[model samples]
Target: MPHLHDDALTLLALGEAPTDEESAHLDLCPRCRADLGSFRRVVTAARQAGAEEPGTAAAADSDNPGLQSPGPDVWARIHRELNLDDALRNDPLASPNAFAADAFDPARPSPAAHAGTPQGNVRPLAAARHRRTGAWLAAAAAAVVVAGAGTWATLRAVDPVPGPEVVASAELSPLPAYSDTGSAVVDRLPDGRRELVVTSTGDDAQGYREVWLLAPDATSMVSLGTMEGTEAHFELPADLDLSRYPVVDVSDEPYDGDPAHSGDSILRGELDL
Candidate 1:
């Protein structure tokens, strides 16, 4: 059987229960399971980011600020950004009936009709289903894009404008038995907090990867944090002495319940302050 479509997976992530067939396929298919997990995580993250107290809006807007609808050009901007069909250049919200009429005009010949087939042979029910599905898919995609834009705008409104600046950096070289090469940089945010940003070509290790700062003598090391992907950011302790621990090391760690480094260093570099 074919894997479930993205629309079906999205529905499942949004709390729609799967059918028996879908459930069976999900249980047996690792790829589908991973995709579903990713969709669920995205949904969960969006919900968490947008969640707010019920009365908070009322408290914040005590003056009852008047709401203004977006201008007519908003749809044009969205269409341009998404590179949507030329047929959808018009604002559907402003003239929904006309949009609907244009989308489902009976005079518009179907593909089967266009191919010189008899119009009478075309099943009206199937055509209707296809039209409905296409409309719903378009609406869903537009909604997702609009929601993403809104979320981005909200985040930009709250986040610092200038962002973080790099303070120091290092070029990581792969150690023996490894071929991965990478770089690490220390970033200082506007709030005076520092973070270590690491990026690498990545390794094919069976275990997890961890970031560490080590002294020149290899006598002391501090675990920054575990890295998930090829790149990660770790918050540096406010009082951490970068001069004392100038060496940045990335190691492959096995799940042995031991917090100590496995000593299987993949990439190592000395930071230039």
Candidate 2:
């Protein structure tokens, strides 16, 4: 059966459940229902994050789907979209994970630390210290806002939510016992789309990177498109079964289109689904 992907579930979650005729087909098809459930979970999760106040649910239900309504803040939506609620709720970085310019090494002293102060006078030193502290505080505050806003905008544009998006990933062979670098991370967006950020070194003499999707059993493999860069970002198919194929492998491929194994595998890693 053709995959009844998340886009269809999106339509249903928007209160446009399939008509009687289509609903019968969906009820009879397990795969379609499973796909729909995943999308609905994502939408429901997104809404739950935004409905901070007790009455928001009622309000959301009453709002017309066609009308222009003030939706959740972009960051809030992203957290929900990406199923990052648990992570964000427990994380130091709540929504957007972007770093602001002033957020680096706040405790590190700068050479120009006292540049704004006058010489020799105790009051000047004290005043300058206060000013410096204040400046740092202001910068820190701005960084927080920027980080939050930036994460929202980035996730919004990238649509980090998981969906039937096209994904590009590479293998990271020989993963450390517990290494973060050997993993590919795909962020979920507020709209239920996903953004796959895959990393691999491409210094091999071979010019192409072979990417594969390892079946859950780890017995079979499916080919994702090949890549050439050290870092590549791709949108994964929305209907991808995260529970099934949880690993991605990146290998070095020659310039031929042959489907046989190259036997020159370089990288193999798992996705932190």
Candidate 3:
């Protein structure tokens, strides 16, 4: 059977009971199960970060405008999935704990609280280790689920973004890739704001990753920003032309202090509007 759709996974993430057939499939499919968990994590993290933000109102996610990175524990999961190096957690200057204390609400656990959590404690990260990850649904029409071990918190969707009309979309394939896959979605809102929501994986193991809007000929490009996690939303410039920059590229970059593309693309895909 074809893997379940994003809508189905969204339901599963919200703890909606699946249909008999869907339940049967989930029971037997660890891949689907892990994907369910991962999306759940994104939603849960989003809500958590939202609440922790000062003066944030309890409204629909779209109502809560602007972008904020997920909390430390969530980044810890990103580290585990990307198999990223230790500097993120170990850098004495970066000081994961200090980053936590100052970044958001002190009401949330300090990074030190999570410090003792042994990385060895198995979290079924992004379809499990070594087995190739299959297709993923962006954390849309989404509810957040935060789970640890056998425990999970499933929050129902208050204002799930309507499955946006995919004005232009693409499936990203691996470049020098090892089990990395992603999708790029361009959605135009009623207010005329065009947003590019990119979901990427497999470069987490590298020190850092960069997102680019590439020219089809692989010549000139525009930098979006650094992807600190696997999923993020980048607002498209009103004057920017996508017809020329129709390709999405993510590259593995080291902390070499250079702001230019490293010429090491890990994933690439062309958009068809």
Using TM-score as the measure, which candidate wins?
3
TM-score of each: 0.42, 0.36, 0.43
Error of 2 at 261 (Å): 3.7
Q: Model 2, 136-229: lDDT tens per residue?
A: 2322222232332334442223221454432322235553332223335555655777756556444453546666667756687766776666
Question: How are the candidates ranked when ordered by TM-score, highest leading?
Answer: 3, 1, 2
Query: Which pairs clash (backbone N, Cα, C closer than 3 Å) in model 3?
Result: 43-144, 44-144
Ranking of predictions according to lDDT: 1, 3, 2
What is the overall TM-score of model 2 with all chains considered together? 0.36
Model 1, span 103-184: residue lDDT tens: 4456555566768987766555324323434334434333332332332243222221344555777778999989988878
Q: What would you estimate as the lDDT of candidate 3?
A: 0.57
Instruction: Find the 10 residues in a row with the least total lDDT in model 1.
Output: 51-60
lDDT of residue 220 for candidate 1? 96
lDDT score, residue 19, model 1?
72
